[model samples]
Target chain A: MVKTDGLHFQYPGGEAFDFPNIDLSAKDHLAVLGPSGVGKTTLLHLLSGILPASSGTIFIGNTEITSLDRKALDKFRGSHIGLVFQRYHFVKSLNVEENLQLRQYFPSKLKDKERREAIAERLGLKAHLKKKVTQLSQGQQQRVSIALGLIHKPKVVFADEPTSNLDDVNCERVLGLLKEEAKLCGSSLVIITHDQRVTEHFKNQVVL
Target chain B: MKLGFIAYKNMVSKPLNMVLSLLLLVLSVSLVTFVLQLSKQLNGQMDKNISPVDMVVGAKGSPLQLVLSSVLHIDSPTGNIKLNEAEQIIKHPFVDSAIPVSYGDNYRGYRILGTDPAYFERYEAVLQQGRLYKTTFELVAGSAVALKLGLKIGGKVVSSHGLAAAGGEAHDDKPYTIVGILEPSGTVVDQLLICNLKSVWDAHDHGDGTHGDEEHREDESNLGNEEGNDHTQENERHHDQGDKEHDHTPDDDEHHHEEEHDLHDEEKEITSLLVKFKNPIGLVQLPRFINENTNMQAALPGFEIQRLMGLLGSGVKTLNGIAMAILLVSGFSIFISLLKTIRERRQELALLRTYGLGTRKLLFLVLFEGLFLAFIGFLLGWVLGRLALILVSKYIEAAYGYVLQINGPEFVELLLLGATLLIAIIAVFLASTSIFKLNISKTLGDA
Candidate 1:
């Protein structure tokens, strides 16, 4: 669950640009659509606790995340939330298994072996577990990022333009998998995108 | 800990750079250690020769030269002082005991000392075999001198005219028999040949009677005529017979005692004298007394050692400063490399942040990486430094005439090395701002 009241954020050392109020709840699939420089990414950062909001209160599962300090924010983010980037952000020096193992860096109560096997099985990454992230193809690397994001069965998942480079077939397939997996885990999915393909998958959408 | 491991791995990744940094570290440390050790060794040798006597009197010149020639068997005398003048000084109420020394000859760079049996006893030189020379032209060999020159007891050796080995006249006919060997003192005494003062005087007296070899050579050349050679031959024969008579003479025999006294009165000559005071008050009192009362100067061995330390230490300090500066610059290079790495890996960092890693933890990781590099570099340097010491020990000993001990690293050096690692770690922390200010949302979008 997530909620934001009058969430205002502005880039420092530049002209100020304010974002509008936002509100969302559990099992919600929210897609934020906006042009470049309209604070589409800025809004997502405020909700996720990665960037501090200029003025507002952000409640995630009834906890005031905006008021938390840096250390607490990081712990809260890693445990309760999962993020998928437009470009997969796997560490180049680490193999796929190590990158996935990093998913356990944060606090978690899940069994390590069970979580590892489940993520690998679901993402079809079992075959390339020993390969370095740099050695993987774009599609395979994306699957590894997806596996890393959902390893802990987080309550909230944030994806920003995750399928921008995928073809229509893979894009539709990835969207379907994200929606199905989020529902199974009892998590809400928030995707930020300008693509029309994102609109077709989610009935619930927010336009900025 | 995690960051330190990664930093170590990164440093080792570039093997050439790692080797180069360690090479510089080892070289600088060895240079400092070797130079400091050499100065200590040289001062120790000087201290050994100086310890037996507390004061030295000679004709007015550098006191160090007098001490060096008279005690350490290096350098030539400033000038010979009158034996009566030396005796008068030694007879002072403050005088404890004095031994006269005469030098100007060497057996292949090993000094030959001309003094009494009391001189050897005062020096506490132990005889390894045989007995002290009781007759003229007989000698006692020092351990090193005997071993190095391949001379055994009863073997004969000739003295070179000059103090050094090069370009010296050899007194071939007056070859001395090695009657005894002195036990090693780990001092300059280990490189000297001790004999009675009369033997030295007789060698000059009967062998053309000259102080220098040139004069001895001139007399021999000028006396080459039939009558002159015959007279010299007669004198040589008489000299040998006189030596035999002196050997058989009793220690307290009045006739021989009177003859020695007559020789002392005729030639008022001595190479140098060593003096010692009864109390610590002599340090302040005697230096002033010797400096003003007579032409002779008094030098404190400890003062000269400290002066030498100061001179060498400043130069060493300058070199150490330059080394520190280079180490700092290398640390900066490490910082820059890490900073750039974090910047280029923003998406990866953001991913880790989403996994509950805090900004503080991330910054610490970078710092650990830097510290790890420095730690490894220091270890490499320490090992290499000891290896270098072993390799150059013989060469250094030969050139400076001082021995270097092979041992573990000094504590001060270890502390300095640790400080360098700490500085490098701090630099890495400063350079990690790129990751500290990272925007997870923008990085995700850019991905």
Candidate 2:
């Protein structure tokens, strides 16, 4: 579901960094384990096409997303690649259900109400559908972020620093949900975190 | 579903800020449009007021005041013009028709105009009910006057000593009988109590009983080829000067007035002579002709009305300035508010873009917020403006005895709404230029 090779980047008037190749099949779970300042965020950015790489080939499903233009790349990223940011920020004006709908709306302007309700039910977010994400508990907000990432059934889901701030028990619960939901959607899950506790759960691991 | 939802939500998020801009916008729009529509109506009314009479021949003074008093019947007369001297202009070959209007008495603040039946023709006024006056002291009430005074046929109107309805002594002579009522034509005739020239003379004649039974032929004549009856009421007072020459009509106390014409031709007076020319050439020649040849001044009603508008123009300009200032202030407030919003909400923009909203849709979201605000402001202002017009219309009807022409959703109002929205668009665009400079990754990561 995801492949990357020769992924390198150089910032204007700044230092350069070279990234390792990555390969993952459908329903695969990969943990790119590294501490802070090890180019973990940079590698994530390069794979997502958020920053143009100096040289790289990034593929999600059958499409090479690195060559896409700004407009096309945004659409490709919205429909094929989902990112779960570290902070789990939702649109402050929209509720939990609406935020999930908005994720689907990014690629196509259509919102699937039934599919959203099913997904909310599976994620234990049915009762909190109308709640603003900020109004939810820390655990609930994290769950909402996961729901947003997998709601559109993207081919590759990136969890950036997903369990970096959690305890051992909560971290296990979050990583379990991430891997399980990714498998249900046939998406390759990549967890980028500095926490050493996350690596044991994933059979596929890469040291950044 | 529509992208405008987010825009609206974002705008209303800061309720205090949004309300400040909205209130100013509404206030300016309503105040400006209210006064403008009113002036437009007043301007229309002036044209209608002057449609009948081309020129007014009256005693020398301000020509505007003369037209206002004699033609519009809203002001006191500029003294009286001698009927004998004013006759030359009335009898001139260029004159098509003439109606001599005499004003001296009032029935409850409404003027009593003593003129011939030709006055009704000049005004295009028809009798709503009852019959025209047949003899001296017979009166006809105008529609508005009758409705207000609750006049009935055969009832009498006692002449008051002054122009005011209240605080005036009643004339000692027999009260004038209400023989007819004029239809409401939205003209000067709607606010007057009308009778023949003999009615005014008889009312002012005090206790003299000789002219009561005289025929209508005794009224002033040789009024050119046209038939017109006009007389002055300077002698209507109960003083000794009026007591001597007041009885000018023929026959008994309640005379028909036909025989008194030739005998009192020099003694008869009219407040103003309403003149219509045979051709448009009279418009140029008549005013100058009367101003130069006769003691009476010839004032064009159209010209005098424009001068009156000019007199009122300064006040309207000051009001316009105030309305414009407030509008600009509102524009500034919106500009500042929107500018601040986009500046502070860079992360919001980043989130929207990450969700699949393109650069173009981002622009739309910002612009939509402004458009919705403008739409709301204009709607509220339009309603407030129309409300003001209704209130003004009521007051004008009560004070001036005429209804203003007010309508809904005028083309000008649409243009006003369109203009307000356009300004809002420009303001929002100028404020949201920072969107182009935003780096989505940096923005999202920093926040």
Candidate 3:
């Protein structure tokens, strides 16, 4: 579960933000609906502990993540949180399956091939797992990003505008796949996006 | 999925940058190693060929040339010295041994050196085939000479007039017969065709080119040493008498034989003498005494070889400097490549950082790339250096008759290997400082 109370952020240049409280349990989902430049990405970054909150409490289970040091927070984020961004990223030298399995290397040195195959099969990425990500279609590449995020089985999946670059068909198909895969892994889903269509599928919502 | 594999793949991802840097690194390291090996081998060869000679007494000329020709046998002789004067120097109390050397002829560019049997003892040479030559005009061929010429024990060879392979002027009248072959000595002795001193005098100074019963009988005995039969000697003398080449025939006169014996003791000339001293005092005093008192000049090989190495050292030093400059340039190339690549792949690094790969792991990834390059550079450079020596050693053998020993990497080359890795470590660390300051939030946000 992920929870945040009185989350406030202040950049070194004095730009500040005050956020509302959020509480979500395992297998629960939330849509952070907002337009561009309204702190949607900032809230995701603060909740994930990528950027420190000025005066706030953020928890990924019983652990308050903001109080951890840089190294410990990195490890905590790796094992507990999954991040998927809109601009697709993959190690160019690696194939699709290697890119997905590489995420497990951050928190744990052991390989988890059963989870990798399960995620690939559910997302319709099973056929293209051995191919280079560059050779895949844009939709397939976005699905690979999802596999990379959840291959380690984190506590909550945080995706930033994952469906923003898709047309109507792919946009709803990707949003549906994200929620379904999060339910299969028994993890909370957080889709932070400007797309109003995502709010239709996710009943639990927050306007940042 | 290993970090090491990622590091390797990322390093080779830019083939242009990796190949450009690796080529220069390999060239510089190979050149430096080759120069060090060649210079060390040259010094080693000179020291080995010095043997036990304290001084060389030869005709007046450049001391370097005297040392090069008499001691190393790689240069032409500086004319001939009188045998009588050289024998007088050998009679001095400080002299332990003096081996008279006379050579002005070659068989296929292999020198036919005339010296006493004590010359073998100086180099510790042993017979590989047959017995030593106990008479005049019988040859004991060196291992290289026999192998190159396909010479057997009973083979006869006629020499040309000069030191090199001259076309005409062949001394076909008095051919020398191979009586023995020396084993491989790893010295200058391995390249010569050695015979008794009388062989040279007979080839060039046999008066009137005629022979009598007594002299012709002695010739048959020497020629038939391997087969000591009276019937064979009679047949050999009879066959030679019919060929009109019975030891330089001129009108078939026999009276000049006695006058030639007179010429042998008084007017016979030799090129030089390898003089070994009984004590260290002669090394300091003998060369000066022979130079001031006798008509011959004395040269100390140890001093001359040092000067020769000094002249060669300056050239090797220049090549080493150029090679070092190239190595420095290669270090900077790798540094700039890693640094520029780290900046260009900022988003990729940001993704890795966001996924909880620590700054230390990122640093190690970059360092592993450098380690891979250094390992390949040193290994290939070391092998290329030795392979080049094998090729160049052929040329060295032809020019100087000395084969440079091709051994494995010694202590100095291991130090070079150590230095190559150190350069990579320094370059990688300098390029990796930005990895610590990477902002995952800002970099991922920018994308």
Model 2, position A175: C-alpha lDDT score: 90
lDDT string for model 1 (B321-354, tens) is 7766666666666666667666766777777787
TM-score of every candidate: 0.70, 0.86, 0.89
Q: Please say which candidate is ahead in TM-score: 2 or 3.
A: 3
Taking the candidates in order, what DockQ does each have?
A: 0.43, 0.49, 0.70
In terms of DockQ, which candidate is strongest?
A: 3
Evaluate residue A7 in candidate 1 and report its C-alpha lDDT on the 0 to 100 scale.
78
Residue A58 shift from truth in candidate 1, angstroms: 4.0
User: Over the stretch A23-119, how does candidate 2's per-residue lDDT look in tens digits?
Assistant: 9888788999887877887787777766678887988788888888989987877777878888877777778887887788876776799989987
TM-score of chain A of 2: 0.96
User: How far off is model 3, as Cα RMSD?
Assistant: 7.4
Ten-residue region with minimum lDDT total, candidate 2 chain B:
B218-227
**Model 2, TM vs. native:** 0.86
lDDT of model 1, residue B360: 76
Candidate 3 chain A: worst-modelled 10 consecutive residues by lDDT: A101-110
- Give the per-residue Cα lDDT of candidate 3 at B265: 47
DockQ of 1: 0.43
What local lDDT does model 3 show for residue B172? 79
B109, model 3: CA deviation in Å?
1.8
